[model samples]
Target chain A: MRDAYHEELDSIGEGLVEMARLVGSAIGRATTAILDSDLKLAETVIEGDKKVDDLQHDLEARAIALLARQQPVATDLRIVVTSLRMSADLERSGDLAQHVAKLARLRFPERAVPQDLHATILEMGQLAQRLMAKAAEVIVTKDIDLAMQLEQDDDEMDLLHRTLFQHLIDDRWKHGIETAVDVTLLGRYYERYADHAVAVAKRVVYLVTGEHADDLQQDIPPVTRVEGA
Target chain B: MRDAYHEELDSIGEGLVEMARLVGSAIGRATTAILDSDLKLAETVIEGDKKVDDLQHDLEARAIALLARQQPVATDLRIVVTSLRMSADLERSGDLAQHVAKLARLRFPERAVPQDLHATILEMGQLAQRLMAKAAEVIVTKDIDLAMQLEQDDDEMDLLHRTLFQHLIDDRWKHGIETAVDVTLLGRYYERYADHAVAVAKRVVYLVTGEHADDLQQDIPPVTRVEGA
Candidate 1:
């Protein structure tokens, strides 16, 4: 019975890693779709999200069933509970990716991102993918240091997010209100995708260290309040 | 022992209701602060969020302790687990309200919503407050029908959100990009606040009927995809 319980735990970890991989690919493709205005690729990412959703649902059921049957205590209990949260974070990350894809689809033949801003959006997307990959690594290896580093990595994404906003608010911005809204929402999607990755890493940090990440200084600021201007 | 367990469960329920009430008020005041450009009220909302955070931490600890100690199974187990999720939703709702307040603070003497849009934003704020109040009512009464109603309430918020964007995209939009960004973020904060309220109510519906809210038709559209235009 104990062996079987450990097996279930291992499977849950694998599920998280799989989810991370899927969502990582999703954001990457969604980015290319947006940058290149590839409607077909955007549609693929949107449809692919269902797979991520199904994985989360299956993982959640197994975790809950384990809780009911094994009645795990101590670290084992924390593992199950935290996995549930990590699954949620990954699921949300997938949804964010899907939102990016939908934005690409909405713009259709017209590019949502202007030519000058393409590089920044591409970099943001790459950073988001890397963060989720690192988050998955933290989960599988339970590497506390790697988990801690994910927060710092998120700072890069935040900088990119701010850069996007700065461009929009600049007097030189020629994009009409419609495109401005598109860019704003797109920046938010990538920023939030990184945030969910950081959240997953923080949960891993807690699982390994038994210390809540909130007790530690947060690397990323909670709210991006515009300074008095 | 059973009575003691029941008492603990009741306390958790009450904690959720209290959280709902606190966040409900926070959104209301945050709305007023933005509309009236009241820095003091915005500061109060920002500071008061700490209370909501502390309450959530306390509630989470209590819930986890109960789970470990009582080893609750079946419906009792569902109650504890679902309460944790609902607490999280409510806590996030508080953060959304704080974001609104922070935006207000950032704007300082200037109103975030233009005079023309003020009525719409005010209605959105009031709708948010009513939805949360209804969510709190559902928590206390476990009235599945009332729980279901909160989703429809959220639809009203989505409509308001859409209207705001329409105004921004219209050829008549004379507001600068900065104001447009402010309005966009503000509309999102209120929309998300209503979403969390609906999420809380859905959790109640699940607790009562053992039916997942996703199985029901979603009241608000998942992604705000613009149709071909």
Candidate 2:
């Protein structure tokens, strides 16, 4: 009976890893769809989000059931509860990725990002994807060092976000108001996607160290506010 | 002993109500700060977020302790777990209010919102505050009907959000790229604030009915993708 109980717990962990992998992939593809203006890929990323949502729903139900049945105490209890929080972060990350895809679809047949800013947006997207991938690895391996590294990556994500905004407000920007709005929203999507990824890794660090990550301070956007004229 | 356990549970519920109240007040003041360009008011909202965060951390610790010591099952278990989630939503709502205030401070001595769009931004901010107030009421009363009412209010928030965007993309917009970006982030901050409040209400509905509200669908931003030019 104990074996079966712990097995259920193990499965919940695996479910979270699967969710991380899916959202990581979604953000990557959504980035490509927007940069390359690939409607087909955009649609796939949007459709794939349901899977992440379903996985979260399943994981949540199982975690609740495990808590009830095992009445887990100490570390086991924290792991179950923390897994629930991690899954929520991953699910929200999936939604952020879908937002990117929806934006891509909205601008279908026309590239959403302007020509010169493509490299920056692409870098932001790729960095966001890598952050999630590393977050998943942290979950499985419980490597505190690897988890700590997500902070630096998040800092990089913040820098890329600032660069994207610089392009938006530059006097020489040729893109009209509509494109500026798109780019601004796009930069936010990528930056927030990375934040969720970093949040997921932080939860793992908490689980391993038995310390709350919130005390460590979290992601701060690179630019605090738009520069006044 | 059981009586004290139940009292502990009641106290967690009260903590949530208090957190909700703090954030509700914060958003109203934050909105006033930005619209009036009141640096002191903005500073108040910014400083007040610490109280909300402290309440959340305290509530989380107490709730976890209750679960561990009491080994609550069935409805009691659900309450403890759900309270944790509610506190998280409220804490995040508090952060969103702080974001509005921070933006106001950043553009200090000068208004962040343009004169023409002030009315729309004001409306969004008020609606956000109202939604959270009702969510606080729902937490205290466990009124399913009142909790259900939040969905309609959220729709109004979405509408206000849409109106703000329309103003942004209009051909007549003369605020330049920097103001446009500020408005875009401002609109997003209010919209997300409202979503978190609605999420708090939905969790109450779930607690009462044992039917997941996510199954009932959640907020769809008034504008899903920035409109294509």
Candidate No. with top DockQ: 2
What lDDT score goes with residue A215 in model 2? 39
How big is the positional error of residue B157 in model 2, measured in Å on the Cα after superposition? 0.8
> Candidate 2 residues B1-229, lDDT tens each?
9999999999999999999999999999999999999999999998999999999989988987887789888889999999999998898888889888888888889898999998899899889999999999999888999988988988788788888888878899999998898898888889888889988999989888898876332433445633541
For every model shown, what is its TM-score relative to the native structure? 0.96, 0.97
RMSD after CA superposition, every candidate: 2.1, 1.9
Worst 10 residues of 1 chain B by lDDT: B215-224
| Cα distance off (Å), candidate 1, residue A145 | 1.2
Predicted structure with the largest lDDT when compared to the true one: 2
Alpha-carbon DockQ of candidate 1? 0.48
> lDDT tens digits, residues A71-145, model 1?
998899999998998998898889889888888888888899999899999999999999999999898888988
Summed over model 1, clashes come to 0
Top TM-score: which candidate number? 2
